[model samples]
Each structure stands twice: as C-alpha cells, then as structure tokens.
Target: MTHRFVGVGALTDVPRVAVVIDVMRAFTVAAWAFSRGAERIVLASSEEEALALKAASPGWLALKDGPPAAGFDAVNSPGLMRSADLAGRTVVQKTTAGTVGALAVADAPLVLCASFVVAGATARFLRAEGREPVTFVVTGEDGRADEDLACAEYIGRRITDSDVEAGPYLRRARTSKAAGELADGVRRGYRGVDPDDVELCLEADRFDFVMAARREESLLVLRPLPRAAVDDGGEERRTARR
Candidate 1:
C-alpha cells in the first residue's frame, strides 16, 4: 500500500480510503462523545444541515464551530462532553476541519476520521484491509497545522510503512508556531481552541474503534466501528451523494 499526505487544499485526488485527521479537538471530542454512550453522530457538511437535522429528528444534538447553539446540548469540545448525558442521543457535528475534510473526500470508497484516540485502530485497519495507494488528508485550520500533520504521521508510522513517533512529534507540535496561533485564537475569542482540547487531542490509542463517515439522506453520518470488525459486517456503507 502506498501512503501520501496532503493538506485539505489538495482534496481533489483521493484514494479508496482517505483517513482524515483532526486531532486538535473536533474528532477527539467525537470519540469521547461516542464512548460516553452517544447513539449516533451526523457529520453535517454545513451549519444549515445540522440545524435542519436537529429540527427533523428527536434526540439529536447540533454543534457548529464555536459553542453549542442556544437549544443544543453541547459543542465540539472534549471538556464539555466529559460530563454531559449522551446516553442514546444522536450528535450532529459541523466543525472547521474534521467534518469538513471528510465531507470533501466523501467520494472515496471509505472515509475514516482519525485522531490520536483512534490512531491505533486506523493503522490496524489500513494494515489489514486498506487497498493500495491509500492517502492521508491532514485538515488544518488555515492552511496546515502541526497537530493535524503530526496525527497523519503517527497513523503513517503505525501502518508499518512510515516512521514517526508521538514523543518528539507532539513536543514540537505543542510548541510550534501553529500552537501559538491557536492559543491566540482562543484569546481572541475563537471557537474550538480550549487548552483542554489540546491536552485531550494528544493522547494516543485512547479508543479501540475508529469513526467513519457515510452519506445519509441530506447528511453524512459518522459513527464509530470497531477496528477488528471492519470486514466482519460492520457495514461502512455510503447512503447518498449529491
């Protein structure tokens, strides 16, 4: 299998499986939300879709970039989901990087959302089942961010074809110019840059499953599937594309 890394700017060329990385906060919060008993997650490509889904469905929570909307239950923050009651609730996520990147590559045979939490599982799936020429799409905030690239490298390494480590990579990422800018964004009142999010995004292999996106009617449904179950009827099927 061949592995290539591209920032979100180059989403045109894709492979059978495109693993999108958003380790900073968006997907990390998603893993935690699912672990806390969230029934399902709808990855809305735009804010309008999230609101429309919230209006049409019961037990659905919508989160845009910054905070939760006035009537929603939570935002895309791991710290926020740490104590929320997500049992049997369906979550709707529309974020700056993670969800958008996956939607951009929805044409692929499969789209898997990656972070440190699901890194190991992603690697295992790619190693065992990925077709030749799998690509990694690192979706950064503006152009490219160290945290997302670091996540891509980590997944590359775990695939046994590339070599990158968490220790040195994360250390540099945490202190990189991007990190500084992210902190400044928070100070400037930006959404999705809590210090706690940075901390949560750095952990490795926190979950046994990886999240994948599939197009549902008027929405992309992203839910976690166990790594070992990828070929055993987990059914990462695409619904509809428009």
Candidate 2:
C-alpha cells in the first residue's frame, strides 16, 4: 500500500482513501467525545454553519476553539469533553483545522479522522480494510502544523508495521508551535481552552476505534468504527462495539 502525506491546501489532489490528522486538539477532542458516548458528531465547515446547525437543533451542542462564536455551547477542549455527560447527544463541531480538513476531503471514498488518541485503531482499521494508496492530510495551514505531521508519521509507522515507539513523536508534539500557543492561550484564560488540553491530545491509542466520516445533508457525520484489535499474530479482529 502506498502512503502520501499532503497539506490542507493540496485539496484537489486528495485521493480515495485518506486520513485527516489534526493532533493539536480537533481530532483529539473528537476522540474524547466519542469515548464519552456522544451519539454522533456533525462537522461544520465554518463557525457560522456550526452555530446555525446547533441553533436549528435545540438539543445539539456546538464546539469550537479560539474566539467565541455567539451561542456556542462550549469551546473545543478535550478536558471538557472527557467530563461531559454526552450520552446519546449529538455534537456540532467547527474548528480551524480539523473539521475544515475533513470536509475538504469529504469526497474521498474512505475518509477517517486521526490524532494521537486514535492513531493505532485508525491504522488497524485501514489495514483490516486493505485500504491502499492512502493519503494523510496534515490539516494545519501551510506546512507548520508540526504536531499533526508528527501524528501522521506515527500512524504511518503503525500502518507499515514498523517500530512504533511513540516517544519521539509525542515529544515533538508536546513542543510544537501549536502546543506552545495552546499553553499561552490557557495561561491567558482563553475561554473554553483548557490547560490540560495538550496532554489530553497526546494520549496515544487512548481509544480503540477509528473515527470515520460520512457525508450527511450539509454536514459530515463522524462515528466510531466498531472496536478493532490486533491479535497475537498481528492480525486484525473486529470485536463487539463498546
């Protein structure tokens, strides 16, 4: 199987099987949301659309980061997601990088969201499905999303059955430009931004299911793939959904 890494700007060139990486909290928040039993996540391409979707659905929750969008339920913080009572609730998510990247490649036949939290499971799912010629969309604008690039590399290594020790990648992510900005934002009391978000986003393999994206009316719906695990012989197995 061939694997290529591309930036968000390489939109028109995205292929049939693609994994979008947003390690500095977008996909990380998404992983946490799924872990907390959120029914599903509707990804909005923009803040306005996210707000409109949440407004239209009375019980839906709106999540994003940076400056507050009026009427947003919460900022896209993994800490908040971990503690949220999201059982059977839907989340409308808009983010600068993660959601935008996923929507940009929505036409791909197999589009999965990725971050450190679900990297292993994503790789396992891809391997089990025999997906070929995969493209990793780094999502961060330009080539500066170091954390995301690191996660992509980690996932690539996992897919290739290579030495997948995560120390180097995690260290790189912890010290990346995005991580520093996140720290500063927390210190400055950015609303809905949490001080622990960095560490939360770095928890590799925190969940054992892949986040698959499917197109819905005016939104991309994200749901966790059924639980996947590797057997002793390194073969993939599907287990009952958790």
Candidate 3:
C-alpha cells in the first residue's frame, strides 16, 4: 500500500482509497454522532440536498455549520452531537469542506472520513485493508487548511511509522488558523460555534471506529466500521486510551 497526501484541489485525481480530513469540526461532529449511536449519516454536498434527504426520512436529522438553513434540525456542533440522543437515527449532513470532500471522492473504491477524533482508527483500517495507492484528502484550501493537513499527516504517519507521537500533530491542529477562527467566532457569539467544540475536535483518537462512506443511489452514506474490523490486536485502542 502507498500513501499520498493532497489538498482538496487534488481530490479528483485520487486513484483508489481516499481518506478525507476535516478537523475544524465537520468530521469531528460525525465522529461524536456515531459514538452517540447514530445509525448512519448521509453526506450532502449542498444545503438543499441535506434538507431534502431529511424531509424524505421521517426521523432523520439535518445538520450543518454556518447560519441556519430553514429546515436543518440543528447546527453541526460537536458539543451538541456529544449530548444528542441519536440512537438508531439517520443524519443528513452538509458541510463546507469535510462532507463535500468525501462525496467528491465517492467514486473511489473506498472513502473514509477522519478528523483528530478518529485518526488512529482510520489508520488502522487502512493498514488492515492494505489498499494500494491510498490518498489522504485534506478538505481545506491548499496551503490554508493547516488543521486538516495536520490530521492527514498524522494519519499517514500513524500508518507508516508506529512510534510517531500524536502530540505534535494535535498541537498543530489546536494552534492552527482554523482553530483561531473558531476561537474568534465563539468570542463574538457566532451562531453554531463553541469553544468546547474546538476542544472536542482536538481530542486525538476519541473514537475507536472508522467512518466509511459509500455511494448509495444519489447520496453518500457514512457508517462506522467498528473496532472489530479495524483493530490490529487492539493496539490502536490501547494507544488511544493512553
């Protein structure tokens, strides 16, 4: 297996497995929702599609960041998802970077979504599968999305170098420009923004499951690949606990 890291602009060039990283809360929210027992998440490339999906499914919830769209059930906040009772419910998510990036590479043989929260599990999944020509998609603008890049690099390192410490990467993510923007937004009382969400996003390997995406009809659906499928003798879990 080969690993390559690239920005969102290179998403179309991905050949096989693609892991999309959106550390500034998109994939972080998804990870929290899955941990809270969400059945599956449908990633929409646009707000309209997300609302439509929610409307079609009676109990499904629609979530996104930014100013509220009329039909969205809630803002895409990791803190809110952490406390949400999402048991057995499907979610429709549309985001600026993460979800969009995943869907853009939906044609790949396998697509996984990651943030700091699921970094280790994702790496374990990749190593277990041994898929060739894997690409890590940083879902931020090239050179401007430090948080996403940090997560991508961290995942790559975790897969190729067992002794790589997550400390430096997590620090980079916490002090990144995206984190600073979130801090400023929370300070100004920006809607759908919270400092606790940033704290949640920065927690490395918070989940032991991988969020894998599949294209179903017109939607890209994400569900957790449980620990049983990704673990290499529980090493990832043990390291995460430490």
Cα lDDT tens digits for candidate 2, 66-161: 756678877788877788888999999988888888888887877889999998888777776676788999987564688999999888888878
User: Local distance difference test, per candidate?
Assistant: 0.74, 0.82, 0.83
Model 3: per-residue Cα lDDT over 46-107, one tens digit each:
88888888888899999988856688887888977788888999999998888878877888
**Model 1 misplaced stretches (Cα beyond 4 Å):** 161-164, 181-195, 230-242
Best by TM-score: 3
lDDT of 2 at 117: 93
In model 2, the number of clashes is 0
Clashing pairs in 1: none
Better of 1 and 3 by lDDT: 3
Note the residue pairs that clash in candidate 2.
none
Per-residue lDDT for 1-242 in model 1, tens only? 67788877876665677888887677888899889988778888788878888899876888767754665557777766777788988998888888878888877777788888888878877776646577788888543677878778878887885344568667756875656765776678766556566666677888888787777766677787764464343344222111
